[model samples]
Target: MEKRFNKIVTLFAGLGLLVSCVSENKIEETFGVKKLVDNCVEKTILTINGLTDADSLPRNILQGQAEWNKVGIHDWTSGFWPGILWYAYEASGDSTILSNARKFTEPLYGVLDVPVDNHDLGFMLNCSFGNGYRLTKDSAYHDFLLVAADSLATLFNPKVGTILSWPAMGEKMGWPHNTIIDNMINLELLFWASKNGGSHDLYDMAVRHAETCMNTLVRPDYTIYHVAVFDTINGHFIKGVTHQGYSDNSMWTRGQGWGIYGYTMVYRETGNEKFLDLAEKLADKFIERLPEDGIPYWDFDCPSIPNAPKDASAAAVAASAMLELSTFMKSEELTTKYKDAAVSLLTRLSSDDYSSKDKNKAMLMHSTGHYPNGSEIDASIIYADYYYIEALTRLKKINEGRRL
Candidate 1:
């Protein structure tokens, strides 16, 4: 009897060991996330401080060979650096990171006064002041963002029932009333503003904009166009064109990702069933087109498929969106599908092909910013790093029984 008991005990102990190994392997898979985020933060501080010390306005560090190339404050990409700093502070609780965040954030005060011509005010003010308000709860940040929302509302036209994306370039060039799929990402700021005592009209405008895009921009299969032009005078449909896509009818990977993220946010803000439906459709299409590794080429329609340059930024954005999307799902199957896809993308991005450890003065690599313009191609983009860290933070929160 004693011998039999010993054998059973040994078998149970071995099973326990197997369970522990499985748990540890899962941890091992994600262990690089913290180390990667920390390394990226350290390199970002050095690069931003060095640039600001040299009397620079502080913007995106696109690429660094011997020296870094940065955009100006007026450039659309300017707001992401401060956002990166805020994420660093949230992850580390380091006061020095907060100081740098403030320094970089103040430069965006001028953006509120600049005339609204594009769908980037949310990208500008919300990234800097939006995160600032959330972290610090400072009234100044709130006031600035409220005014920025008002500035954005200036471009909304009741006739067109959507906010204008491209400025009135010229009659001969067409596109007097153009709204791109990218504009969907900007509505979060409008929703936040209205809820926080800004304007009800702003909320209405956002809903109308989403409706207009849903009507024209999204195809039946959930593939999206880069740009859609309409008759400004009467809200008549003009034509759809490709500004930064493979063709006029192809899916621009980043743009489709934006659609998913944007519609997910709209559903969150409004509890509208239609917005949720749209988000789920876009999410399904995006998941269908993802490469086996989950990262995507700049455009899904690119002929080079296996050899195409991957855009880590799009994956980062999509993963973040999927994590949020899982919370709104009703079915266990869909929740698992979206959440697992997010984890897979995050895992691949943290690998050597994408993750960097201060190697080239950037965090996430292999991000293609604008394939059509041949600008910032195959480099580390600041926004890519921002969203990657944001997704990691979201996952950490989920593990700890919290929300981001």
Candidate 2:
């Protein structure tokens, strides 16, 4: 009887060890997150080393070296570089990455000194200070972000029922009140502020903006317009058009990715079924239209299908959003479908086809920033790396059964 008991105990112990080994791998080796994370850490250091000024943030890498987003140089993308560091720190558990993240993050405090006339503050601060606050639990970061949230709310025209995306650009284009699809990304900041310590009205404002966009921005086919214009006095949507898209009728991949991520986050924050439904719809439309490799062209209607520049940035955001969205699915089939789609995107991006391992310091390549403006075409964009790391981290958290 003693011998039989010992044998059973040994069997159970072996099973426990197997489970531990599996659990230790936050991502499956087949998925390549572990390798990619190490690469991300190394590349992040390389990116910082290339920078000469602390105030200038790394933005893109088109070829041999890195580019920057400065005070006036595509400053909307400023937050992503620091955001990448934070995510990299979380993945690698390296204190050096933490210090680097804080170093790049503090310089953005200068953003508060200037007037907040544009909606990009959310893109600028939330990705940097917002992640910092979440990870460090620093009250100062929270307070700074609250001020930014308040500043963002100032642009919300109750008349238009949406946060104005471009205040100065509206003047340039003769738009009374213009709201772009990218404004959807900013709603997360408002939602986070409402739950943390700021006014609950911030939550309400986010919901209102989302609902308004749902009604005007999304078209009948479910592909959305890039920009929606509203009459400032009457508070009615005037027309939908394109600024960065191939045409007024074409769906821009990155804008669609923002809508997918924004609605997914709004659903998480509000528990509203409508937002979930919309996110699912947007996600479905995006997934069905993707190319064979799952990375999207800059525009679905670009007139050059097989040859159009792929937007790895779009793929990164969609994968991250879908991973989170998968947890919210009510059905197992829905969950699997979304997760599989996300995995397909991540796998392709993690593969040699997209990884910028030997080519450049950036994690992934071939992202389209603004094709119509002829900017950052087929380049290594900073935000793409940020979201790619974030998606991998989300995969890790999901494996650990932790909250995202």
Candidate 3:
């Protein structure tokens, strides 16, 4: 046991060294943000292009494009990569990137518009159609978004006041009565639809569901449960379980990050003091436990495992959330602190060791998808890349106004 503990200590110490090295070499070169964004856009486009071949799909980290041909075009996960590409293109204003994103995403128009009862409509249409609207100001994207929103609203259960997770994956692995922290992201699309589509019912339903989640799923300490099982008949909370984390009560880092940002967004949309309060509370807990380098382990309170590593993706996601929270706050000092922390985290990630220049890797590094179940760890994830770019974009816009 002593030997194992020593190994864990050594691993953390090595990671601490990497953090120090990155901080020492923080790149202050002009246009560094733009360059990183451009690199991510270019690499992601190439990755999508490569996945067109069957042999390359399994090896492809992002959703494998070759799966599209075999499984047909409606695959949900396949849309996320191109969706992110569209987002990056919109942010950077590169016509080529936009063109590539359209080429990759246009096929999904038929699939997303087909009235499917999937939980991932937000994942599919929001990133693609939503981004297309943001980029091109095309009414078609808005129309698709409203259509998808209407389809999503069909999943809402009046008893639970939340969207059902999926149709019925089956009894053994079923989550029909389950609500997850990740679903908070999907609610954003509902909020958007409510505003733009002129549906007060949609808006009210989204708010009520968000309130239900806050009451049941979020702990007093601000750590979030991965899933909450509700008694549909009684309209009461039954129990909490970890669908993705290590255990029932473990604080999954990314899930917490989702809560942090999701609540802030809710506050933004509704002007609800409770949502803002929850966002601040969750942010406090998250920042308090983060390592000195700003990244966190997959679970905040988990026992360390050999070869299991920290997740920079969670850090990147939380940093973006912090920036959002900073803007919402009235205190200048607090805002500056949050902004500085975000910049520090992103600067560390952009270092040579973490941010791979190779087109194949395509992300700022040290992302862990799932550690307890032995999934991708210390690897580049698409969401990590997405949030990393989002952070940089936020920083660039802020710095531009401040002018050093």
Candidate 4:
């Protein structure tokens, strides 16, 4: 009887040891991964600060004939930098940052009214005008948004049931037949148009564009192609091709993020079941591929890119999108799963490794702007900064409930 009792005690002790080991492993996986990402964010912020001067303008802007050299030019990319700055300001309530952002955006008002032949009008005007309206509630911002919407509406093609990418350039590419995954961002203008301008046509066009993208651009597995060529004359799918990714069938991480977020936005605007379903499917695929660190590579399918670096920007964007999708999910299991994943990613970004306490760069690390083209790989991109702050903001709101 004594021997038997001793054997049972030993068995219970071993089981408890195993459970403790597993628990420690899980905690390390969560916190350890976040530490690396946080370091990246710190470095990025430091770098951005180094690039700027006392006036809060980038030192590069002081150079002659650079894109940032001009004060009032309609720079499509400027909005992202200021947007991130605004986000940082809002997060910390730092008055100096807010003042600098206003200074940066005030000069660009001239070009916001000018019609440009770019697909990034939403990235440009939406960040500036939308933020302006949200902050000041000024009618001028609303007016600018309307003008942008008008320009964007002209890009819509009824045949393809989507927006024409950009003006046909040197090549024989059909204007109305061209669509890209990035057009997801452009759809926000349509949503604003419908809400502010009372244009049902814009909303209908946005919905159809999303549907066309779903039918033509997205794969059965939820991975996305960068661009799809359609028949301008007859609304027929022509061919799917990759513009910036490794190959036509390759899964670009940022493109997947765009699909995830875009579909979620579509669901929000229209309450469409199909959009929500697609968003969930894409989220599933994304979460499955995350590394132990929670950050993703620039392209999931191209795991063998020689010397290719990880893209922190893509991870940040996907994290923000996942947070948005979490709100719409009915399953608490899924909500907790996605919300935790997003929080993990954001926590990593906010850690000392990813973020700089000195505020030199104003970004978090691991941004790859372009790898195949050998441009801006593993560098700090303005949009990456913006999306990272957006992810942080969303995470804060989620944690604080509706108070934020």
Summarize candidate 3's per-residue lDDT along 42-139 as a digit string, tens digits: 76666666555321112124322222222334654455566677767866677777776777667767675465656677766786677778768788
TM-score of 2: 0.95
- Residue 7's lDDT within candidate 1 is 100
Cα TM-score per model: 0.89, 0.95, 0.83, 0.80
lDDT of 3: 0.73
Error of 4 at 63 (Å): 19
Candidate 4 positional error at 397, Å: 1.1
RMSD of each: 5.2, 2.0, 13.1, 9.5
Query: Taking the tens digit of each residue's C-alpha lDDT, what string does model 1 give over 226-305?
Result: 88888877888787788888899999998998999999999898899999999989989988998877789989999988
lDDT comparison, 1 vs 3, better candidate:
1
In model 2, the runs with Cα more than 4 Å from the true position are 1-10, 22-29, 64-74
For model 2, the run of ten residues with the poorest summed lDDT: 65-74
What local lDDT score does residue 276 receive in model 4, on the 0 to 100 scale?
94
Task: Give candidate 3's error at residue 24 in angstroms.
Answer: 22
**lDDT tens digits, residue span 38-99, model 2:** 77788887777776666777777775654444443238888998899888887778888898
Question: Which of the numbered candidates is closest to the native, going by highest lDDT?
Answer: 2
**Of 2 and 4, the candidate ranking higher by TM-score:** 2
